[model samples]
Target: MTETEVLAVAGQQAIWACLMVGGPLLGLLLAVGVVVAILQALTQVQEAALAFVPKMVVLGLALMFGGPMAMSVLRTFTEDIFAQMVSVGGLR
Candidate 1:
């Protein structure tokens, strides 16, 4: 592939990787925020901690569990990019 074409593909792959890695954690935070907002409305609890704690806990867990998989994906991407760089004469 031409260098421009290869770079475009690599850029697309990196964007996809970001979405996959962040989608779960962002989804969890969204769900938790909605729940916390509803609960606050029902009980008039205005404490920021109430809204913050669950999202933090759940997102932390998501990262803890998915961190390895995310790292693996990223590492593989890096290796591929470097390989391509060498192939395209960008690296020696």
Candidate 2:
């Protein structure tokens, strides 16, 4: 592969790893935010904590439960990059 191809593959892997790590937490946060917004609208009592607290809780829970998966994704990405580097080095 050319230098540009190697760079492109690395970039794509980085993006994929990021999405894999963050997608679940972001999705949960979005859902919680929407629910909080609707509830606040219905009750007409807007407290910042109402929104902030749930998101914080969800974020914490997500990280706790998803930490291993996230780590795995990062580890796999790192390994892949290293393997690619080895292959590229052999080309030199």
What does candidate 1's lDDT look like per residue over 1-92, in tens digits?
Answer: 99899899889988988888888779889998999999999999899889888988998898899899989988988998888888888644
Model 2 accuracy (lDDT, Cα): 0.94
* Model 2: ten consecutive residues of lowest lDDT: 83-92
Tell me the TM-score of each prediction against the true structure.
Answer: 0.91, 0.93
In model 1, the clashing pairs are none
- Candidate 2 colliding pairs: none
- Tens digits of per-residue lDDT, candidate 2, 10-55, equal 9999999999998988999999999999999999988999999999
Q: Identify the candidate with maximal TM-score.
A: 2
Model 2 ranges off by over 4 Å: none
Please give the range of 10 consecutive residues that has the lowest summed lDDT in model 1. 83-92
lDDT of 1 at 64: 92
